[model samples]
Target: MNTIQDISKFSSQEKTFVTIGTFDGVHFGHQKIIEKLVSDAKNANKKSVLLTFFPHPRMVLQKDSNIELINTIEEKKSLLQKTGLDYLIIHPFSKEFSRMTALEFVRDLLVNQLNISKLIIGYDHHFGKNREGNIVQLTEYSHLYDFVVEEIPAQDIDDVSVSSTKIRRALLSGNLKTANNYLGYHFMLNGNVVNGKQLGGKIGYPTANIDVKEDYKLIPKTGVYVVKSNIDGLETFGMMNIGNRPTVDGNHQTIEVHFFDFNQDLYGKNLTIELLYFLRDEQKFDSISALIHQIKKDEKTARDYIKNNL
Candidate 1:
């Protein structure tokens, strides 16, 4: 896949089939639209292009406050590239860009810059200043621009719209099962392993500590989870925790994973963790023995869940 970060480097073509969206998670619903883009482009003998924005529109509009993301830029690119699209156009969203009218946006960016032949969008997808462009405006422009327009219906399962918001909510609530189903894969977190106080080691469950560097990335509620950790190319089953070590009076919340039946030094390395199940809520144990007993049970549950399902 070719990534076009600047509009100047777009290299206008005779025709291209394109869709535009932020596509945060690139969830199953987004995949359906992308699959259509691919098929439509192939059928029309044109390049398949995805026009997405960086920093998310909300971040630019809201400035200081914005909800965290489901995937980072690197993660989004990786996922989108796997769908076999021809081109990925990343527009740097800004205040000036946000001010463009629907017609100006279509004429200058979509038509004039990229030379889109057929535009595909979701049923409720809107664009331009203040979301002024809707399907009606697109239809009107189709006649003038001499391009075709296709609207993909909103995807839903059992009347529930499959959306990024819903998936994020599920993840935040520690409902990994529902989140995974919507995402069409495991809910994953990528981070760098960092040094910790070795509290887990003292309790016989050594953990690999990870710290994520992201301004707007969602962190799940404090709990024990059945997780699969990827170190280099090796995959290991583990139980991960996202919370403060309450028993030891540790105040900072951290992400730590203890691999099942495995011991290895993973400090300073990057790792990806996939959450499979939510075991129990975080608690403050009365004593060290009580904490250890609860951890043992959590480990057993994680092990059993992974063995049976993962």
Candidate 2:
């Protein structure tokens, strides 16, 4: 799929079938809409276009700095690419763009700029200047613009029984199974391995400290999780800890993964860890020896789970 960062760069003369949304997680519900967009466009011999916004409209318009997203912009693009879309347009969301009136958005952008022939949208979707444009307004404007508006009814959308909000909630609450069920894939954490204090090494459980650069990415609840990663084309299992080391009097939270039966220098390597199961909540042990004993048990449990499941 061709990805266009700017809408103006889309100079295709072919009329397009378009759908617009943040499409945050690209969960099952969003997939249903995308499937229809691709299939219908193919059947009609038109180009399928997905117009999404960056920085999230809420982040700009509502000044919501604390809002966590299920997928980063790059992750969303990677997921959407698998849906067979002809074009994916990621428009920047800003205060000025949010001020555009509903009429200007439809007439100036959709009709004149995009050359959109048909718009496939959710049933309750609203947009443009305080979200004044609804399905009713879209239908009215389609007549003036000489295009079509197809609103996927609420029942059709709810058939998937999933939403970005639900996925976020599941992850935040350590309900990985429910979140993965809705996502149709395991939740992942991508980051670069960084040097640590060597505390784990002293305890005979060295770990690779990961630094996730995206501030808005939603991290799962603080706990020990069974995770897997591909190291040089080999699938490796690991146990990950996501919490402050209260026993060691550590102050800040850290994400550290100790790969099972694998030893290599990973200080500068990038890794993607996929969470498979929630092992247990992090706790402070009374002594270093106590913590080491628990770590041994956690390792065995993680290994057994991976062996049985995989």
Candidate 3:
């Protein structure tokens, strides 16, 4: 799939089939709509185009700073690429752009810029200044611009929003199974490997500390989890700790991964770990030996789960 960072930068005169949304997780419900879009576009001999906004519209228009996203920008792009989409256009969301009227958005961006032949959108979708553009306005604009406006049923689009909410709730509650079910894939954490106190090394369980820089990216409930990552083209299995080192009296939360049968230096390397299962919630052990003992048990449990299920 070709990814366009900005819609204005793309020079295209050919007509296209387009859909517009944040498409945050690209979860199962979103996939349903995208599938119809790609299939219909292919049947009609038109390129499929997805126009999305970065910073999320809420962040820019409503100043929603506390919103957490299921996937980062790169992660969202990676997921969308696997959907057989033709063009993924990520446009910057700003206050100025938010002020554009529904008519202007349809005329300037969709018709003039993208040369849109058809627009596939959610049944209740609203866009443009203060979200004044509903299906009613979209239909009118489609007629004026000589493009088709196909609205996915309310039930289908409602599932997309509902699933997004359920996925976040499931992740924050340590329900990995439910979260993955809603997401249609493993929930992942991507970050750079950073230096740590080396306390796990002393306990015969060396770990790589992950430092996720995106403040908007959601982190799952603090606990231990079974995880997998592809490092240097090789698949590696591991257990990750997403909590403070309470046994050592540490206060700040840290994401640490201990890979099985691997001992290579990983400092400064970026890693994407997919959470497979939730083992247990984090707790403070009585002593160093006690903590080590519990970790060994956790490893065994993780290994068994991986062996039987994976």
Candidate 4:
């Protein structure tokens, strides 16, 4: 798919079938909308365009510094790329942009700028200037602009019992299975491997300490999880821990992964770990030896699960 950062750069003369949303996780519900967008565009001989906004509207409007997103911008783009969209337009979201009136958004942006022949939107979607625009306004604009507006009814769009919010809540509660099922894929954490205190090595379970750069990206609940990653083009299974090392008197949270039967210098390298299963909640063991013993058990459980299910 061709990704355009600036809407003005999209100079395509071909009329487009457009849909707009944050499409945060691109979960099953969002996938249904995308599928219809692509299929409808193809059937109608128009370019499929997905218009998404960056710095999420809430982040800008509410100054919500604590907002955590399920997917980073790059991750969202990567997920949407698999949906057979022709064009992905990522527009910057700002207070000024949000101030545009509903009619200005439809006439200036959608009709004049995008050359949108048809708009496919969710049933309850609202936009423009405090969200004054709704399906009813969109239908009115369609008549004035001589364009078509297809509303994916609430029942159609919500048939799947999945949403980004639900997935986020599930992950925050250590419900990896429910989150993954809703996402239709494993939840991934991408980061660069960094040096740790070498405490795991002393316990015979060396780990790669990961540093996630995106502060807005949500990290799952504190626990040990079964995860997988690619190292030197080989799929590697591992158990990951996300918590403070209470046994070692460590106070800060850390994300560390110990690959089973594999050892390599990964510091300074990037790793994308996909969470497969929730092994157990992180515990404050009585002693270092006890913690090590539990880790061994976690490793065996991860190995068995990977063997049978992977």
Measured with C-alpha atoms, the lDDT of residue 110 in candidate 4 is 93
Q: Candidate 3, overall lDDT?
A: 0.90
Clashing pairs in 4: none
Model 2 ranges with Cα > 4 A deviation: 153-160
C-alpha lDDT (0 to 100) for residue 59 of candidate 3: 77
lDDT of 4 by residue, 1-310 (tens): 9999978788777899999988888887788888999999999898999999998998898885688899999899999999999999999999999999999999988998899999998657889999999989999999999889988764323455566778899999999998888888899999999999988998899999999999889999999999999899999999999999878876899999999889789999999999999999989989888898999899899999999998
lDDT of 1 by residue, 200-236 (tens): 8988999999898886878888889998976667888
- Comparing 1 with 3 on lDDT, the higher-scoring candidate is 3
Extract clashing residue pairs from model 2. none
- How well does each candidate superpose onto the true structure, as a TM-score? 0.97, 0.94, 0.94, 0.96
**Top-down TM-score ranking:** 1, 4, 3, 2
Model 3 agreement with the true structure over 1-310: per-residue lDDT tens digits: 9999999987677889999988877887678779989999999998999999998887776664677899999999999989999999999999999999999999999999999999998657889999999899999989888999999873333344445767888899999997887788999999999999998999999999999999889999999999999999999999999998888967898999999999999999999999999999998988999999999999999999999999
| Candidates' C-alpha lDDT | 0.89, 0.89, 0.90, 0.90
Summarize candidate 2's per-residue lDDT along 109-146 as a digit string, tens digits: 79887899999997588999999999899999999999
Error of 4 at 111 (Å): 0.5
